[model samples]
Each structure stands twice: as structure tokens, then as C-alpha cells.
Target chain A: MALADARAICPDLATRPADLVREATTLAALRRWAGRYSPMVARDGPDGLMADITGVAHLFGGEAELRADLHARLARAGMAAQSAVAGTFGGAHALARHGGGIIPDGALADRLGPLPVAALRIDHDTAEALGRLGLRRIGDLIPRARAPLARRFGPGLVGRLDQALGYRPEPVAPEAEPPHFGVRLSLPDPVGLQSDVMAGLARLLERLCEKLGRHHAGARRLRLELDRVDHAGVQVEIGLAGAMRDPARIAALFEKGVEEVDAGFGIEAMRLVATVTEPLAPAQIGPARAAPQDGMDDLITRLGNRLGFETIQRLAPAESLIPERSFQVLAAAWSRAAPADRPGGPPRPVMIFPPEPVMAAPGHPPARFRWRRMALTTLRATGPERIAPEWWLDDPAWRSGLRDYWRIETREGPRLWLFHTPQAPAWSAQGVFA
Target chain B: MRCERAGSGALQLAPTRVHEAEGFGRHAFALFQSVCHDGPVVWVGPAHAPERLLLAGLPQGVGERLHIVRAGGVDLLWAVEEALRAAPVGLVVAELETALSLTAGRRLQLAAEAGGTTGLVLIRQGAGSNAAQTRWHCAPRPGAGADSTLHQWSLIKNKRGTLGDWTLHWDGTSAAFHLVAETGERRGPAPPPL
Candidate 1:
């Protein structure tokens, strides 16, 4: 049925709902597939994609060959696509919408001249106004006075018209690259022996370390991927205590991980990648002092490869004043920021447990307190360093009162630290000395 | 000594001066020494109540030289890198319940290589993708000895080497590794108690 007759017959006909998300996903998939033809691709709109194939066109033989390939691929993917090549995004959009064949770089205006003004993507109201002013096509409006056109229809109309003829430049930004160092080995034949895999890994690690050395960088995390002949793959990652570029050290770390890669039906390919990298500064070498053997690092890498990275951690001092909040356990892979000078005072406990209640006076040490089923008596007492809570932050316990901390040496030779709040009149064991 | 040799010439070789050497009392003891150590940091018990246990243990006089960093909100990869850069006295052991991204893991690998220090990461099983070197599954083993307060452990997987499946009997009081033979197979002598 004709659109006008159908609209006249039915005053309120509901339009079919458009699946926007599906269309967007399809467009993204198309963009990825389009990369096979050219790296420079941009989404023209909901249903279009613009690909720059200047030098890439010859790869498929010529522009005609490239267009035919695009049509065949889109047809196979069940999409109805129309493509045109021009010097600019605007020209391409216009030529694709109007001109059927590919137009040379400078001939966009001539080809687009006969197309309706709607091809400029102007608003329906503006197009209707142009139609009423006897401006039915782009050819009719191109010769009109610029001042009158801008004053009557707004500058956007002229801007869109100029953009269609390649007067404006548009830039397409690419995706960000992931931070990783990788090396690959393509085996001549699938190998199932563990020794072969290890040999391959050793070679890859050497290459990766060389890359790290050149970049003045070290990796904290490394991954080895084994692509098997059965279409499945195995991947292993090893984390380190610090950034390091030593091939032996890195290989040691992956020792356990390499064993985990199942050569299911034999492995055909291998890839080594460093997932985390940090800047490495030059080390100081003294003539008199011999370099120490790094056995602990090798052990850590082997353990980390098998057990995983999160299970390992190192305790670092935190800035918080609260006893439990004053220290933190960080992962081995992350580099620690340099420690700042602590405020002058007696030493803090090396190990701290969660707050445990104690029975003691505010100023005196507890005569006897129960902890983990053991009764402890204080032999020495010191400190009443009162710490006030930041009122600006919401804290339920801070509402009780300020805490006066005491560093006390216990009779068992273990130093016990406790704190008492004035408002609550109760004591709590905060931490212990190593 | 001369009389005994005369009585039996075949038996008595003058009872060879059996003098035992005394301890070295005058020599000063050296402070530094190197030792080969392996194993990981372990935390036993349920996730709701975690117990941070150091498996490799601390070296003697470590209290004087060791540095502990309490880094909250920092990712595991960066923590490992930091520990590697701080070598000799460097060792970073963490128990993380969270997962890290691929990029974070790569950064950690690079840092470990550069620092020439060991990075030990202990993550809860199944918390994230299995990307670690070995990927072990540890479970509590039944105690077997006079010390009723001991826990046994099993080495589920060793990715680096063929450490085949083996049971380790641990005494909580002593914290030692004792190899336990599999129940069905009796091919080897019993491991001596520590």
C-alpha cells in the first residue's frame, strides 16, 4: 500500500519496535570483520559502516574487487549492505545513499548534486521548509545565497550540506592497547613431552626478559598459553614478588605453571605473555660485595605458579591510626610505594589482631586478661597516647569516646598493647609484638 | 694401656686414644648464611575465619632486617612487583579473596622478572580464573599421631615438577613436613616422625 493512502486509512498505526541493542551488536561485529579489509573503520550510523581502503583496495585486486568481497561477506551474514568509496566520511555517506558506484575523490559534489536534500540528514521540518521554498534537491540549494540560507533555515543546514560534499574532516580513534609482553612459538609438529614444553618455555622466557631489559621494565605476572591439537588450550600464569627481568628467575616462576599445561592430544602452539609490567631502575653493584643468590625469589615463583597469586601477600604499614587499620596485606605483584617517616614515638607492634576486649583501668595495665584461652599479666606499662576520631567521617565506635593506647610488656615475654576509651570505660587488646 | 695390649695382641690396639674434641668456644659465629627453601604461604580454615600461616617460615634474625608492608586497596600484581624490587630481605606473601585482570597479572609477571625477587600469591580456590603457575587444591588431612592437635596436608598439583600426589603430615606444635605413604600402596618405608 502507498504510505499516504495507508496513513489516510489508519490514523493510529503502531510502528514495529526496533531492536537497537541487536543492531548495535551487529554493527560492532561488522566493524571487527571489516578490519580484514582495512584497519580504518568507523560506524556511519545505526545501519552503516565507513572503511578507508585507499591502499588496501589493491589487496583484493582493486576497488571493484573489494566492493564485491564486501557485498559477498555481508550477503553471507544475512545483511543487506550498500557501499561507496569517497575521499571523506561525509562524501562516502552521501555517495552510498545516492550514487550506486564508487565515486572518485573530488567528484562527490557532482555525484550528490541530484540527490534530495533529505540525504543531508537535515530535520524533517527543515526539509519540508526547503521543499516549500522550491529547494527540492541539493543542486537547487547549492546555488542559493549563503547568507539568506543561513538566516532562514539556520547554519546547521549549510553545515550538513558542506559536510556532505567533504568540506569537514572527521577522525576515527582506535582502541587502546593492553599492557603485556608476549612471545610465541609455532611448533613444526605437535609435541606431548613435558621436556619439550619446558624447553619451549625457556626459549620464550629468554626472549621476554630481553624485551623487558630493553624497555627498562620488569613483569610481576606472566602467562603461558598452550594451544593443543584438539582445538582446546591450556593457560598458566605465575606472579612474582617484584618487577624482575631475569630470565632464570622468570623461568623458575613458571616452572610449576608449565607442568600444569596439559598437552591434550599434543600441543601445537605456545605463547608467553607478561600481564603486569613496571619500570625497573638500574641496580647498584659494589666491587667488594658479592651478589647474593636469589633463592627466595625462585621459591616464590614456583609456589605462586602452583598455588596462585592471591594466596600470597606481604604486610605493609598503612596510614590509619586505628590499630587494625594501621597495617595492610598487599599482593606480591604490586610494587609498594616507599615508606614515609613515621611520627616520632615508641615502636608499634609488628603483628596486630582484631580488637579483643580487656578488663583494665584507663591509666593502669591489666592485672590479668583472657586471650585465646591464655591469661596474661602485664609486667610493664607505658603510654596514654590518646587518638581522636575524625568527626567528619561517619564512625559508630568513634561516637563512644576517644581511646588512650598503652604499650605494656607481659610476664610471658610477649608485649601486649591495649587501648581504653574514656566514654565506654572498657579496655581492648589492639596488637602484639613479634 | 700397655698391660691390656700384652694380654690380647689380636684385640687390643692400645684402645686408641679416644679423646673427643670440645666445642669451638673461642670462634665468633657468622651472622649470614644461605639456605635452600621451598613451599608456599598457607591460610587454613573457612573463608569467614581465615588464619594467615607462613609456610616457608622466617629466617633467623629476620625481625631485625625484614620489612612488612601493609598495602590496602592495592592490586595483587603491584604488591608482587613491590616485593620483587625490595630484594635480599624481600618476600611478599598475600592471601587475596579477590581476582585480578589480565593486564594486572601481566604487570606482575614483568615486575617479578625485573626485580629478581620471589613473589608468592595465595588466592582462594575458584575465586578467579585459573591462571597461576601451578594451581593447587589443598585440603585438611586427618591427624595421625600422639599430637592430637596436628593437621595433615596433601600436595594436589605441582605444575613446575612431577611432585606426584603426596600426603604431608604436619604437627602444629613443630610445623614440620612428613611424607605419608598412600593407604593402598605400601612400597616404601614409613616416614620417620619429627
Candidate 2:
């Protein structure tokens, strides 16, 4: 409509340019507010929201009561909204857009019989084509043969009809519901005190732990987000040394980080999310003495977060024959102590140094060898234990091919491990058997 | 003298700058083996760490509990301090190439106290000065014991209050140490393996 025509309808017609920022903020805040209604709430389009209320309606005293309470909450917030709950997303969406109310389960056809073909939510052109064919009501399409209608109007119309009638499956992809383990609280009044923040954390932890327990999982890392009254957000992340489901232990680990939370003008809201989680089951059998395991984990976690866990580690034994690859270093917090070395294997050097080439005098045991600027006479020599390279792996050290290793005692009293690879036709000092 | 209580004191394992390659690893690892039975270990070193050297002297499971951190000298102190706070950490060892200031040493001590974890600072080449609980000088006496690395360890500085000398014979079989002499005295090629 022209500005003059719009002005004629309402002489004092006023307008302002659209603010994308304000619209985005409103949508974000709306999504946040919709959490209490269900964990899975998503903005459907520019002016609509889809909720997977599945098993949550009974909490507010059945479907009708929940629907009434939701409408009342919207009215109080001064945001007008129309909602419909159906067994399927298709049914709910169609009912909501075309004057929605409570649609009983198993009555999608009966309840939508009188509604126009537009209720199927097809494109306007498809609806107009169906209208021209005298199939104006959804009930008209439901009773007729599906194949004929599909051939005539195409699958778009058939799909819309099937979806609305609850034949096709519809799954709502909620906007990443803040990691399923998250819980948020909107304060009755903005609180700035440390005690208030702690209390808020307590409440959030309780709910989060309950959910975590139901899922049989433990949080390995947590992020506490404080939404201040001034619109500033403070996020403090705390990592766990091990998976933990105990609320008290998790709370204790987070005490230091939370103390650093800048309240700003006061926190109007708070959100706690378990960013990393792992499957954890309660101890089936208690330890004979609990003194060691629990306390040690706490200490490791506290120190790891305070300093950095990567700085702490345990040597994990790797299943390999190569000296350098025999053991793997793992984060101390996440790994267990490696088992004792198996006996009867060739005596391997405790310390495996980087390999260096050797210049040797030609002989069965190489009578003399020079390495690291020192020439040593091999007075005593042992076996030529052959170690072949793993065919599946590409190791630079092993690129020289098969090796014949010999344990030799140098004139200088250094017990050394030297290997000769025929592929390279060269000898190299592999380790210092100190 | 090793195996200090976790989180109670910060000790120094100083290998004379002159002979780092000769004995630094032997005694540092022996010290690590001494206390590792109590808990886990975190060994923080500089980039291009010779980690395999540190664990090689100790026996299988004993060395398996060591966690390694490779950072530069600038971040060494921070890594050591943080390691001191890791509760289950029985020991935190840093292979430092530079000298540690008194303030840095004091901060490490305070952190150890807070975390109740012990700090073992391994200096490749350090001056004879520190407020650490103890300072040791380790040298490899390769022919000193029967097939064992007889490390001639002298108590160069004993802040725990005793400057005693001892020869720690590292038994490769058990991955443990046996004090050979209290006088810290040794003869050339002392007796063949028993």
C-alpha cells in the first residue's frame, strides 16, 4: 500500500526503520525464556517457535492445562502468541498457523476436516490448484485415493497432506539446547553478593546433577556463565581431573573459579553447562580403603586446573617391540599406572636415545667403532638379535630396513647397543645401556 | 637424599654444569624412582626433551607413572608451580637450563605447600646456591658397581640440615637404590658383581 493510502486508513500512521540487532536480541531472549516450557525449544521462523513438549506436558497437569499456562505466561509478558500441541510437528505447525487450539491425539483428520486445504501448509500455488479441483478441505484429500492426487498435484501436495495427517515422521532439530546437561536460573532480583552466586550455582548444580545421573554420565568440564544486569557475561571454565558425578566434589573444584566471577552490575541470570562429559557408572563395589583414590583425584584435578594438567602425566606402556615406541606418555589425570615389564625379552636399554650413525672397521663384530667423537674398541660382543621393521608402519628410523643388534662393551667401559642394517649397509649406535 | 613428602618441600637435583651428560639423568631418575611409589610424577622439561633418558634408569611400572611437560625456560617456573598444585602428584621435576631466582624459588615452595605436592627441580648446570630442602651433585661411576650405575651422589647443600655423602647403587633388576657407603667415598672399580 502507498504511504498516502496507509495514512488515510490511520491518519497518524507512524513508522521506524527495522532494527536487525533488536530483532536478533528479542529472538535470543525469547529462546532463553522458552526453556522452562521444555528443554527442546526452537525458533520455527521469524515469528514462530516449535517445542518438543513430548513428556513434559504432564508436569503442568496434562496437555490442556499446560497449554493454558503457556498462553497465560505469554499474555503476562505482553507478547501475543498462538500455540498448538499435536502428535507430530507437521500437525502442530499446520494447526498453529491456521487458528490453532488444542488438537486431541488420534483426531488429526476429524479436527482438520473442515479447515481449508491451506491448513496442509502447501505453497499458495499448490493450494490454489487443489482449490480449483474442488478439493478445498483437508478431509477431501484424506478420503480420496492418494496415488491419483499425488500424480495430479505432485508429491509436494501429497507430502504436505501426509505430514499434516501424521503419516510422515517429523523430528525437530532444536537449536543446540546448550549441551543437554545445562541448567539456568533467572533471579527474582539481580544479585551481586558472593553468597547469591554460590546459591545460584547450588541450584543449577542440583538440577544438572539429577539429569546427569539419569543419563549415567559424569561431567569432565564445566562452564559457568553469569549474565549480569548490565548485559555483560562472565564465563569461568573448570576442568576435572577425572569424570565426576558427585555434586560436592564438582562444586569444590569450581570454588576458586567461581570466586573470580565478576558480578558486574549484579547477575540477573546464570547458566551452567557441562561442556565435556563422559559415561560414568557408580562404583559397583567400594574400595577396601578409600583413603587413596578419591583424595588423589581431587588433588590432581585442582593442581591440573590451577597449573595445567598437560604438565602432569604418567608413562603408559604401549604394545610395541620398538624401543622408542615401547612406552607412551599419557596425561596423569586420565591414565592409569602401567603394568610391570614382561620378563624374558632381550635386555632393552632403560634409556632409548636418538639414533646416530657409526663409522666402524670392517669385522664380524666391527673390531673398532667411532661414535660421538669417540673411537671405542669392542672387547666383548654378544648376539646379533635381528629386529625387522613393522611392515604396516612407516618409521624413519626403521627405513634402513632389518637390523642385526649386538651388545658390546667398549674399552672405555660403556655398554652400548649397536645395530647394522644391511639395507643401508651401515652401522649405528642405537642406545647407551647405562 | 630424595623422596620428600608431596606438597611439603621443594628440593633441587643439581648436576654440575661441567658434567651434565655424565650423570644428570642417572641420579635424577634414581631420585624419581625413590618417591614415585607414593604417587604419580610430572616431569616438566624444555622443548626437545630427552624424556626417554629420564625414565630409562628406573624400572618398568615405576617409570610408567611419570608424566612429561616440554616447555621453554620462561614457562618452566609456571609449569613447576602448577605441577606443585596437582594434588595427586607425588613429585614435580623441571629440567631447567637457567638459574632460578629467590622469588621464583619461594613461589614454588608456597605452591608446593598449597598443593601438598613435592617439587624436584633438576638443573642441568646450576651454581651452588639455593633455598631448596636439599641440593645434590650426581656423577656416573660406570665401573663402580656390579653391572649397576653406581652414582656418586654428594650432598652439596643440605637445607634439611645434614650434608652427608653417600654412594647410591642403582640395581637395574629391582629399579631401586642401595646406599653403598655413608662416607661418600669410592675406590676405582670397587669389586665385581656379587
Candidate 3:
């Protein structure tokens, strides 16, 4: 059946589906793109974006030029957009939808007077209430006493009307800034030589490092992209030892990373960027002015790049009292320096592993302990530092018993190891000390 | 014994004249020189193993110039800022699972311009959005010749004017890159035809 015939047969019809997620995503992308024109862009609703272009309007030659630019860009992107410039967000919104381009900012009421009551964005019940009271137009309702009108229609109606006429304040919340570092390269005819690619990268790196150096900054994270001839592209990135701004150094780092690309067909464009950055302090010069040998940081960077940043580990203080849980292994790129040892603490072992069960009796140190197929005789033993389980938490192991830890000195040397008595009569080897 | 004890006490109470005779005290002069000179480099990396290995590999002369600053859960831009503030020739490299914000990226761009040093960032292949100048995707390849001594690498993106797909025959032991013949074929073995 034709839509006209179907509509004629059905008096009430609702055509819109409530798909909020898709609408929200589209709005977010729109808001992000709108940032090109104004840094202060906000999502007004599910389908609208508001840009604070007050002083920025002049940058595009005028308000008209800005509007035209926006329209053109939206058109290119295949979106239908309507815009209005007003002193207030409500007036602009109402005018954009009701007055189109005819109404100016100061004449919002005059321009909006003729529009239907529904343009005020009131609920259906409110509109019906207004209709029953014979108040069909905004101008018609303005002459009524404020107290009486508010009493009859509630404060929301008055507030909406006031906002539409620019009587109330409106604020625009800007979007959060994104993190990125980039350098663009325009090529002539899109060369495809590896040497040429590296040369371009070197130039870009120089430009990037110059910018970073000026700000006393370096990049911890870097990304490289190749816009290929097929309209597709490939990206490669690397993490840094620390933030750095030297083009030669950065380029050298990429020299190792660029070996992964399979330039299907050929790439026509390239770009380099640092996704993460950090501040770098000025370097101090020595009195003798002799450059030192391999710096600790440089060695770390080489090792980090080769072994993978995650595999590089460091010890950090843990809250646990258990020997196995006293220190944690953390990634170097992400962790700070290790915490200092506690004052007047017992000496710790060079290495520590999880607890190992041993055949032993309570209150007595094992004459011999077998670990990893090796047996060691205990020549001396220290008293057990009793540690009670935290009763607050329902731990199954805690129910086993309280532990009495002992530092046993073996015949070979002093090995910091732990032996715990789970029950009153049984003892087991628990861990090695580091 | 009393005379000897009195002489030792006098020596302890008296100011040392040897420092004046030597022009300046060695400790004080050393302290002054250190105060006047720039501090060491802070090595920041993703983790400890690679960081330690890299530190170990550095020339001994450069090793003394370093102070290691290990970071955790830090974004790339902040890392760059830390590098800029901490070291004169500060270098930061990070492995990230996501892309940096546009504002952060722009800030880094400005920071790089301000500092005369260098920043190198590493990311996983095809992980985040495109926002870099020169991006190169690297992968390990088979070695050439009977000895199997060299490994090959492919250059994916060289925004520094290094274009096209080229091969690098690398000597792992030497940790250096050497130009190799380009097969003109893709890096991996060709896929079977449909």
C-alpha cells in the first residue's frame, strides 16, 4: 500500500525508532570534527552540536564564512546540518529549527512569535494544556501575568520561554582534548624506495624533534604511518626508553622497527608521530667536558627494545608481610624507583621462591632440606618469628595454622629461608629469601 | 704516653693546612665541580629486563650519565614531558595498546619543536589510530646463504623520505643494519592462489 493510503487508514503513526547508541556515536564524531572550527565544541543533544565561536568567528573572515565552511564540510561528509548564530544557545537552537535564517539574535521573540507551541520543546501534555487555555502562540502567552501563568503551567514552561528569549544563562561544556603527536609529509608522485622512505622519515624526525626540543619534551610512544596507493595504509609504532627529542636517535629507533612492513603494491605517503610525550630537563656539562662511557639509561633503552618492555622487570615494595609477597615485579616503563629498605630490618635473601613442603617435625629445624634435587644440612637455626593469619578474611590456608618463621644458617652459608609450622606439630619449608 | 696523647689531641683540634697548601680541598673542589655540571640521564623504559639489557649494552662512558626512572600505567605524552624535564638528551620509548589524544599529540609536537633533543616511541602494529610522522612496521625474516648468519627486515613506513619496500640484511651479533637485495616480493611467503 502507498504511504499516503496507509497513513490515511491509520490516524496515529510513529515513524522514529529509539536507537540511542547509534545516535550518540554519530554525535560524538560530529563533535570531534567540529573542533576544527572551534576548540570549544559540545554535544547539545543526541543530534546536535554547539560550538562557541564568539571571538573565533573572525578567524574565518566572518560569521557567514564560518557558517558556510561548516555547511560545506558537512555536505562533503554527507550530513544535513542547520546552524544559527545567537547570543544564547536556546535562542540559536529555536531559531535554527523554527526561523531558519530570517531571525537575528535580538529579535528572537518577534521571529519565534508565529511558530507553533510545539517549537518550545514542551511535553505533549503541556502543549495540550496550553491549547485548552486558548494560548496558541508564544506571543499570545507573553501578555499573561507571570505568577498566574506559572501557577497554571508549572515553572518549567516559564523557564523554557525565558531561555528561548535569551533571558536565562546557558553554558557549553567543551569536549576533552585527545593525545597525539604527529608530523606530515607531502610527497611528489609518491616514491616507493626504502632509502627514500628513510630519508623522508629522517626529515620528519628532524622536524618532530625540533618541536619536542623547543618544549623540553620527548616522546615515550611513537607511531609511523604509510598512506598506500590503494587508499589504505600501514602503521608501525615503538615505545621509548624515556622521552627523547633527538631526530637521529628517534630515526635510529625506527630503523629497527621499519623492518616489518610488507608494502603490498606500494605506499604513496608517510607520516610520523609521537603518541606519548614527557618533559626533559637540560643536560649538565662536566668540568673536564669528557663524555662518559655507555650511560645507564642508554643501556636500558637498548635492552628494553630487544627484550620487550614488559619483560624488563623491577622490584617494588608490596604491602604483604609474606616473604613471597613482599616485592612485586613491575614493568620499567611504568614503575618508579624501588622503595628503600626498611630501617633495622633483618637481612633479606638474594632470591626467593614460593613455599616448598618438607618432611619435618614441629619446634625443630630440619637437619637436612631437599630443594630442586639438592639437600642442604642446617648447622644453625633462629627462633620462629610468629605470624598470625589475618582472621578478618576467610582464607583456607589461614585455617591450616599459625606460622613460626625461622632463619636457618646452613653449613655452606647463611641462606635466608623460611620454615612454617601450619599445625602445632608439623613444620614445612615455605620460601627462599632474596 | 701523656705527651703523645696531648700531641694527637692538638692535631685533631687544629684546622688542616694541607688543603690550603694544595690550592683547594679535593672534596670541596669536587663538590663544586659536580654542582656546576649537569646531572645524569634517567633511563625510562616499559619494563626492567629490556631496560637493564639496554643499559648494559651502552658504551661505558654513557653509563655514568644515566639514572633509571621506571614508569607504570603512564600515557605516552606524559612520558614525553617527563623526559623533557629529566634529561638533557632525554629519550622515552613506550609500548602502547591505544592511541594518544589529539591534544596530547599536539603538545608533544610543540614540545619536540622546543627541545633540540629526540623522542622515540614504539607501538604495536595496527593497534591504534594513525597520528605519527614516520611509521615503520618491522618483522623478522629468514637469513641468506649457507651459514644462516644474517636476518632480513622490511621497511614499511619511512616518512623521512625513505620510500618503497626495501630489505635490510641484519647481522644479529653486530646489531647493525645492511642494505639487502629487494626481491620485489612481499615480506612473507606468498599465499596460495584461490
Candidate 4:
């Protein structure tokens, strides 16, 4: 129920916003921890877990004992959990939510009969429709003719019934853990110099690169952790423009970050981990391709490391009538250079500012106007290029309606691109034609 | 630095040296893009500068080879020098609203020489004494014909040759500059039809 509706019935109601992402993360962590019970454990739904304890039940003595142990352990950990074991995953899932317990072998049908038809896992609408026809319990649908029920209620209604009764297979597929790529080094005596730390990093990189090479993957981001003797540990992260594996190249990229590590007394240990990686197949280096464009890539990477990668950009003309939408500024680090194409359009301004309102007289081209604290008089004007907004797109800037643009040369010496919207009848100084 | 003569022998920019151009309405960019036809150009500007090149207004294929870098006040010169030292780059255009010192100018010039790249320093306000090879003062002529574009270019400082001023007509489609004639300051009626 909504908090507002509930609070009217009972004056004070406590509520908190739901975080689905955090709940899913917690469930996934629990699924990993449940690996000790059975290797084939999978998340059943939002609030439950399902495990295929096929041959592993003997290890815990019996199915009932295993379920009790699992439930007790979760309760000890401050989590209230209900568990049910059965021959089929659907049977166990239904029992866990509705009537949880151990279902004896070949007795799935008898045990699931007392539960409501909603326990069959059909949607609420289908269950409500079935209830109106006097089939309110799972037992009511068991004896019905398959053909007519299938036609009226659809295949999903019958499919969920068969799966719960062990008449169809519902296998539990477990989630696999990803392999971690990290290497650590410990020194007997603490080292303080930056060179010593770099030496340690080099050794770690050699090991990490070898692992990456075996997997045919390359590192896109790396983290180096320095464990200082007296102070808290320091972590330096390196972001790469492209996936790289070479130790020499990776070390060169780390040159700027190495100085940021402060070894309070001395650094006892260092660890390097490849946090983000991408598949990169080995390519043969030949003399023919060595001198071509490596210098440009190296320059981009070097500059991107100092300044941010996004600040370095290349502009490409886009196909749009809107002046601002006619060009795109792409990051040089990620996007390949776009080929130059001859664009068909009128001359655009060299510099464009976000549209700012201007005070203008009531005239065709606005003979007099005040903009950016300067009073200006138009000496020459040329245009009424009418450009309509794209109706399909909702743009706040174009809310006022169609615009008629003009290139007005001011007596103050700067040519301005001004626009007058007829629908709302307002003037805005958009850009300067320098 | 090697100076290549233009077809009209009017305005030429040398590769591997710093040339300072004053004013924003000048033909320095028009002349630079016309001369350096090969290698990539890197444009470095301060993060606060409001002006930017209109790619649609530039000639065909020039926007593809151009790279723009925006840096803060302190890193502005550093970014310029770094771009000047890249061999794959043909030219570096540094747009400055602040002043450039003689030492900083010499350092940028040396980097350009080492990388065999040209550097154009565009100063909008203060054009202090610098170690650049040439200093230019250009402005759009007032009474040019409505159709034809004209700009007055003054080569105020030249380390290797004599200084002179000329009136140049710009062909928009061809992206070429033709020398019209040497002129003294006379502002009245529009120039005669081409």
C-alpha cells in the first residue's frame, strides 16, 4: 500500500525507498555463499534461493536435515529464510513460498494440491480468471481435461502445473564466478624510493601480462595498491585509451601516477590488478606498419593521461538542419576519426554560445539591441533563413517555435547570428561569426 | 624553418617556427589552413575561451584532420608545447586571451623546430614582445562589396624579410587568398567589383 493511503488509516507509517539494484547484489552474494550446500544453487526469485541437491543430499545425511541446516545457518546470521526440497525445482520453489517442507519422492502432486492456484506461478490475472471458474486450488486443475483448459487458460497455465508436478523438467543453472587477474609482491625490508616501488610494479606487471596473454585479453584499466608501513594504504588507478599488454608500454603510462604514492615510513607490499579488460588477439609487428600512425596514437594517449581523455575532441559535421545539431564533437580517445564529407548548408558561425535573451527594438532585423552589456546598432543585415524545429523531438530550446535567423554586422565590429521567433515573438543572440 | 611562397606571393607561413597573429577577425586562420595542406593540425585553447571554429564553415576535409584541446590556464601553454612537439602534427594553433612571455614563446618555437611543425599563436588582446619569427595585424576592411570578401593583412614584424601590408580577396569555395593590391588606410566607399 502507498504510504499516504496507509498513513490516513493509521496516523504514523514508516517507509523507505526500495533499491532494487542493492537487493539484487545482496541476493547474488548470497547465491555465491550457498555454494557450500550444493554446487548447483541458483536464485529462485526476488526473495528466495533454489538449490539442486541431487547427489549432495547424502552429505548432509538427508534432504530434511540439509534444509534444516541451511535455514538454521541463515537464521543464525540474522536472516529469516524458508527452505523446501523436492524432486523438481518448480515443486521446491512453490513449496518454499506457499507451503514449505520436504516433499517425498513421487508425491509432488499430493503435496502441491492444497496450495492456491497462484502457487502454480501463473500471473495474478490468470489465477483470478481460474478462481472465477471454481478452480481455486491446484487440486482443482489436476483432474480437468487438458485440451479445453489449455485452449482457455493458455499454455503457460498448464506448463507451470506440469513443472510443479515433476511432469516437466525445470533445471537449476548455477551462476559462475569470474576469474580475478591480480598479482601481489611482499618485501622483507620496506622500500621508500619511487624506483623501488616501480621495480615492484614491473615484476607484478610481468606476471599479470602473462596471465592476460594466456586468456587472449588486454587490460583497459589497472589499479596499483601500495601498503605503507605507518600510513594508510594508497591506491593509484590508470585508465588506458586502448587495451594494452606490453610491460614496457604499461610502465610508461604509469610514470605520472608513480609519484603520487606517499611512502609514509616505507612500503611493505604492493599489489597490481587489472580491473577492466577486453579481448585482444595478438598481432604480428612488421617493419611495413611500424612507422605509419603509432606516433599519433602515442601522442593522444600521453596527452589524455595528463588532461582528461574527453577534453581532446574532434568535430564532425552531422546531418541536421538545427545549427547546434549540425555538428558533433567526439572524444578522440574512443571514436575513430570520422571521414570528412561535403556538407550542404548555409554558412554557420565560428563560435556558438547557448542562446541568451537580447533586448531589441520592434523592427524586421532589429536595428538596435543590447546584448552582454553592450548596446549595438546594426550596420548591415542579410537573412531571414527560416528553420523549423523537428516536431518529432522534444527540445526545450525550440519550445518557442520556428526561428528566422539573420547574420547582422554590428557597428562594434563583431558579426552576430541573431534569431527571432515569430510564434512567441522574442529575439535571442545565439552565436558570433568570427 | 622553411618558408613556402604562396601562389600570389602575398602571405606565407613558415613551418617549424612560431608566428603571432593579433585580433580575432583577421585572415590568419584563413591563410594558415590554406598553406599547410598536409599533416594534422592541433588547436589548443583555454577552457574559458568562448570562441570555437565552425566545422561546417571550414573548407572540405579540414575539420577531419583538426584536433581541439581545451586546457586550464596553467596547462594551456603546456598543452600547446606538447602538441607542437608531435611529429605527426603539421601545425599547432594556440588561442590566447592572456599574455605570452618571451621565454614561453621561445620554448614553443624550439618544440616546433624539434618536431618539424609550425606554431601559430593567436593573441586577441595583449601581443607583448615575443621570440616569434613574425607578427601580423589583420582586420576586415570596412567597405568591401556585399558579395566579395576582403581583409587587410599587415606584416608588422618579420625577422627574415621586409614588412609590408596588402589587401587580399578570399575565394570561399576554393579556400584561396589572392593579393588584390598594396593599399594605404582609406575607408569610404566599397571597393570596385572584382
Clashing pairs in 2: A299-B87, A303-B85, A303-B86, A313-B67, A350-B56, B6-B116, B7-B116, B7-B117, B7-B118
Question: In candidate 3 chain A, where is summed lDDT lowest over 10 consecutive residues?
Answer: A289-298
Cα-based lDDT at residue A256, candidate 3: 61
Q: What is the TM-score of chain B in candidate 1?
A: 0.52
Model 1, span A1-434: residue lDDT tens:
96678778997976666899988888887788888998887777788877877688888998888899889988997878788877766667776887557877677778778888988878999999999988998989888888899999899998888777766665555454333589999999999998898899889989998888777888877888999999898998777766788886677566656766678799999999989888987667658542443444543454345445554455455667655455566654343333333333454553455567875533365676766566667666678888888677767756767988887666553455688778887888766432
> What range of 10 consecutive residues in model 1 chain A has the weakest lDDT sum?
A335-344
lDDT by residue (B1-194, candidate 3, tens digit) is: 01121243211111110000011111111111122224433334443222122222222223333344455455334555444432244333343434555565455545544543233344444443234444433332333342221222233443334434434443222213355665775488778999
In Å, candidate 2's interface RMSD is: 4.0
Runs of candidate 2 exceeding 4 Å displacement:
A1-180, A187-203, A210-216, A246-266, A282-291, A299-312, A358-383, A408-416, B1-22, B25-28, B53-60, B113-116, B127-129, B144-149, B160-169, B175-194
Docking class of 2: acceptable
DockQ of candidate 1 (2 decimals): 0.03
Ranking of candidates on TM-score, top first: 4, 2, 1, 3
* Per-residue lDDT of model 2, residues B1-194, tens digit only: 33343332222232111111113444344444434335666667776655354244355455655566666766667767766765666666666677777777777777887877766666655642355656666654544323444555666666446665556665454534566646534668868899
Comparing 1 with 3 on TM-score, the higher-scoring candidate is 1
- lDDT at A213 for candidate 4? 88
Report the TM-score of chain B alone for all candidates: 0.52, 0.72, 0.53, 0.83
Q: What TM-score does each of the candidates earn?
A: 0.53, 0.61, 0.51, 0.73
How much of the true contact map at the interface does candidate 2 reproduce, as a fraction?
A: 0.41
Q: Count the backbone clashes (under 3 Å) in each candidate.
A: 85, 9, 163, 0
Winning candidate number (DockQ): 4
lDDT of each: 0.58, 0.71, 0.56, 0.79
